[model samples]
Each structure stands twice: as structure tokens, then as C-alpha cells.
Target: MTTRTPDAEPLLTPAEVATMFRVDPKTVTRWAKAGKLTSIRTLGGHRRYREAEVRALLKGVPSIGGDM
Candidate 1:
């Protein structure tokens, strides 16, 4: 989507995403680095993910603009 409003899409932490994928948190970070997941950075450089995208992935759907 071209316009993603912050309030409309909920955010997920790396741990939360890992839990959904049954992977480790570090693996989730690796996925982000590999461009498999779309990440939003916090001021402190922590990553956040879109809940919808995460759910889509859990259901075997590809991310909106991601590698997987």
C-alpha cells in the first residue's frame, strides 16, 4: 500500500513476530535484515512490524513488499 497510516496498522515486536512464526527473536531480526519482513524502526533502533503483515505471513501469505 502506498499510504500506511500509523494508527490504522498495529505494530508487533520482534519477539511477538518470532512467536507467531515459531522462530527465535534473532531469526526474526535476520528476516528483517534479509528483506523478508518489513520493519519499522524506533528512535532507539528497535524494530516493529505490522500486525496484519505478520498475520498474513503466519497464514503463508507474502508480505506486502517483502521477500517472503
Candidate 2:
């Protein structure tokens, strides 16, 4: 089994993640609800995402027919 990296930071807020992906905050929330992205909840019920996971998702998205 693979071990996790100790140097890795925790999670990012929805707003920060939205800025990273260039999408609206609600989009991040939708992704979490649909299981496309993973998030954790705070005691106040706020959502947060793992940056490494988000980066992996970004890599899988195909560019627009070479236009991107």
C-alpha cells in the first residue's frame, strides 16, 4: 500500500479552490455533491478540498480541440 506524504497540507476552502479552477464557488460545491470532487466538512459545516486531488482532476480534463 502507498503511504501519504507527511509534508502535504490539509484542505482548501471552496473559494480558494474555485479561484484555482477558474470556476464559481457553487461549481465546487456541486462537484462535491456529485462525487466528482472530494471535500471535508468543518465543525461549522464549511466544505474544503485537497489541493493535490484538485490538481489531478485538472490534469484529466481535455483541452478544447487544441484551442485551449
- What's the CA RMSD for each of the models? 5.4, 7.1
Q: Compared with the true structure, what per-residue lDDT tens digits does model 2 show for residues 1-68?
A: 53559996668899998898899999889888877787898778999888877776678753222211
Residue 15, model 1: lDDT of 95
* Model 2: lDDT of residue 37: 80
Candidate 1 lDDT, tens digit per residue, 1-68? 34667777788999999998888999999988888888999778999998987888888886655555
Error of 1 at 60 (Å): 1.0
TM-score to true structure, per model: 0.79, 0.71
- Superposed by TM-score, candidate 1 places the C-alpha of residue 27 at a distance from the truth, in angstroms, of 0.2
Top candidate (TM-score): 1
* Local distance difference test scores for all models: 0.85, 0.77
